[model samples]
Target: MTEILLPSDPEVRDRCARSMASKAFLTVWEGAVRSGKTVWALCAFALYATRSPDGDFLLSARTTATAETNCITGDYGLLSLFPGAEYRTVGNVRMVRFRTRQGEKRIHVVGASDIRSYMVIRGATFGGWLADEVNMHDRRFVSEALNRTAMSHDRRHMWTLNPDDPGHWIYSEYIDRYEAMDAGERAELGGFAHFWFRPSDNPAMTPAMLASLSRQYPEGTPFHTRYVLGMRCVAEGRVYPFFGPSCVAEPPEGVRAEFASIDFGSVHPTAMGWYGRSPDGAWWKVAEWGPTAEESARMTVADYMDVFERETERLGGIRRDRLTIDYGGGGEALVREAERRRWYPVNPDKSVLDGIQATAMVLSSGALRVSPSCRRTIDELSSYHWREGRGETVPDKVRDDFADETRYAVSTFIEPRIRRRRRWSRT
Candidate 1:
């Protein structure tokens, strides 16, 4: 095994100790992003695997790719804890084989994203399970996964995740119930232990890093409250609360790249935005266009294409690969038409919350700005809000065409560049 240098932070050390000592049926480390909870859980699981009963163990995340990245091959992942660990595939299942003090152990890695993913473990049994980002998994998959380990002599499960809505099934069904139970009650129902982690709990986070992360998710925003403080809160109020006068500016010269994004609609108004990225990595929304209700009602794919061409030419003709469009509703037809025209239009990532979060972070950091002439886009930015009275956190869809288009542009084009820049800076 490689030499491991543990941090000296008392709280972090205590959490690590608790993880290794936990005898509960379910051990959960829930908290903020970069809180080191996943590392702690993985370390604990590594210890458990050595002495665990002779049965298959499972390691899972929201997707198989994420499971492999975060658990098996990540910097502080399971394989890193075991020097000779190697991944192998048995049929459709992926497993990590490693020798421990007792004997060789095999742990299967799986994705628990889809509700139907439970079928993967339907007939299989596991001695224990380690699930990263468990809250993102479907409730059906989670329930079934826990049942898969019920027959094992050492039936333990470790889960780590960032905070979500208070009403999320993971919170209400497990965390809340575990917290509300008395000691006697908890003991009778099989032990459950929950550990809360904050960004400060991560020893690797320097003061400068914490300050930078804090600036990305400003205070008084849902992203800050949930991701920074590790609180279970629903997104409310304006989606782009930081999009004030400062976020509205004229386009800069010497642009490095330009792109356009569209939110297509036939009944509703179609919205399109032309965006440019400056050399310093800031994004500027240069122009926006939308058809009136009457025009949208009568417009065919060809008409829309004509308008797109005119707008593209007017805004200095963006490359075909830079075009992003929503792939739902009438947007699908628009994408096909763009392809037929020899333009390779890409579909934007439609994960609403993730896109919204990325957009908000850039806007808050002043890395994203919109032209004052794009009046409709600016209006949507200020008025976009979370839907109220909904059990889940959902952005209200009213008058959000321009907002969706902006999100598509920023998330599809700007976010990836921002991530690349950050990684480069780190290196």
Candidate 2:
């Protein structure tokens, strides 16, 4: 068998070379877009296939669309690397077969959008597995793919991705885990080897390409981070992109109006925010109760009502006429409980998107103030994000619980007050 030399892109070639040489259970090649991470991972597998007889490998992406578009294992460029090899796509293009000097190599491509599809191949085995854009795939896919090869102690699982948000599972788990190992603070995951590079290392990137990228994407945007500097970006499903450490602000003294917005939950969390009206006619968030999970069994309607009452009192004062909450489900019963306790429990506005827009408007106008005490709310506001890849700034529904509730509360009460204040000033 002849050794196939990779392309002239040293960064891509080096990443491929590194993966080929690694002995760890997990070989990770992470970098920014256009840094040649994908090409390198595929090339390394191709080289391995030619050297190892009947080598069985797996190629996986977040979606079939991605698997087709990226064209890693089944594509021509990857196949072209191996000279005089017969390549064929089988089983609806899920698997790729190659007949070569080293023997027969099978590459299977799997698309996982949800956890159920990942469960199908639970007990399967493989020689190697390549997870592309790992940040985009479901976390369960990672667990399943890695475990499937558990029986093969020598099997290598490779992951390639760009930097993602701090909240992302990959960053928090894989990247952070590797960093801890390097710092001698943690034990390394057996057979795990991770490497990272960026677009700045790519000698193939020309000045014209940089200029074109600049023209195509806005400065400080995800495209700039992922493709230009090769930085990790926040996941697509985050809601509070604006919630971060930099946006912290002090709450004002002597509130004129105070209300609490409660979001009831059991598995997700039962969240609440205490708000106050400041002297400057701005709405200030004083505190929050959020992202909390039930430690034991499902929280009963009685338990939620109890928590709501406690949070309301902690906020200073909750007038029976001002307290609001998300509508539907057990909201009415909770409202009844609030009424019994002499705390207002009106239904908040229901539109998630409208509430998001309403809160954004308040923040943009500098009318929204967040107290240092409202750590969770503040964090949610800063870190909540959207899928920029689809060309929009809308918040992701999955992680926008607090933001949605804020919007609903603001739309129900604060928006009207702000509108009235604006109208009064004009008059």
Candidate 3:
């Protein structure tokens, strides 16, 4: 048997021990990111599979790639626990084959990203199931997965996830229900065990790492509240609370205007921004333009194109490849017109939460700044608030035209470069 070194954190060790000993039908480890929950859950799953009932096991994530990366091949994942384990793909199914006390057992890997994911596990019975980032999976897939494991003798399931909004379906349906149940009620339904972990619980995290994370997600912010404190809370108030006088500045000298991003609209204002990069690699929003509601209603695609060409010329002409535009709403007409002129505009990445987080990180790190002349952009920054009661953290859509363009420019262009630089530095 291979020796497994456990974290020194007593709480983590105790939870891992309890997970193996518990007679729970469902076990959940939920909390902060990199909080050792996945490691603990994987360890418990390894133990469960050794003696679990007479059926194939299931291992899943929001996507197949994620399932493979986080659960099977990650540094602290299942394959690490079972050294020399064989992983293979047969037809549509990806699985890991490993020796157990009973015999060789297989764990099928699947992704439950959408409603259609339920079809992947429809008729198959599973002895046990282990899910990573269960909150990202569709509710229908989660329901179908649970049903798939109903016939096993153990019928146990383990789940791990970072904290999401309090009103999320996973919380309202499973976590809340479990917490609300009386001790007798829980016992009567086999059992449901839950564990909470904070970053401090992860023995692998260095003090410096914790400090860096604290800086990345500042205090009183939604990211800080959920990720650092490991709390499920609603996101309210200003979305970019960090944007203030420090973030607004005159365009720095020797800045090269690199690209432009457009948030096209017909009913709402059509917004655009010219972004530049300084010698120090910092990003600056040098200029912005948008038609008023009245002007937007009267402006045709030709008018918008003329404005785009004039603005591009004023900025010394940006490469067509660097231009990004929102493809939704009335933007498709603008995109087609631009293409006819041989200006291929790339579609912006419209992932709201991720874009917001990346934008926040850059702004907070002083890597992003906006010219004081961009009044509308600055105004949107101050007024952009989270949409309440949506059961998810989302920026309110009203008056968000400039905000959307800024997100497109930063997230689509700058954030990936920053991530690459970070990765390179680590390597």
The most accurate candidate by TM-score is: 1
Task: Rank candidates by TM-score, best first.
Answer: 1, 3, 2
What are the lDDT scores of the predictions, listed in order?
Answer: 0.85, 0.65, 0.86
Give the lDDT of residue 316 in candidate 3.
Answer: 81
Compute each candidate's TM-score over C-alphas.
0.95, 0.51, 0.92
Per-residue alpha-carbon lDDT of candidate 2 for residues 1-427, written as tens digits (9 for 90 to 100):
3334354667556665777677566777787766666666666666655565336777788776676567543433444555454445565556666677656777777887566767756777777777877777777877788777766535667778876565666777666676657533333355556777665445556677656544433344454455556666643544434444444577666763377787765445556777887766777877777534543156666676676667766566667687787656446666766677666677888765446656655665467777787666665666676755543334554555676667767888888888898799978
Question: Mind giving the per-residue lDDT tens digits that candidate 1 earns over 297-395?
Answer: 788988988999998998779888889988888688889899999889888988888898888888888888988989999999998999866557789
Q: Which lDDT tens digits does candidate 3 get at residues 1-427?
A: 3355566967678876786565588899898877878877888888888777564899999888998888888676778777778889978899998886688888999999778999999999999899999998989999999999888988888999888888989988987898899989998877998988888888778899888877887566688888888888889999888889999888778776789999998777899899898887788999999997778779999899999999889888888888998999989999999998889899999888878888888887888999998999999998999999979877788889899899999888989988898899898
Itemize residue pairs with steric clashes in candidate 3: none
For model 3, where is the 10-residue window of minimal lDDT?
1-10
lDDT of 2 at 397: 49
Position 413, candidate 2: lDDT: 82
Task: At residue 131, give the lDDT of candidate 1.
Answer: 90
Higher-TM-score candidate of 1 and 2 = 1
All candidates in order of lDDT, best leading: 3, 1, 2
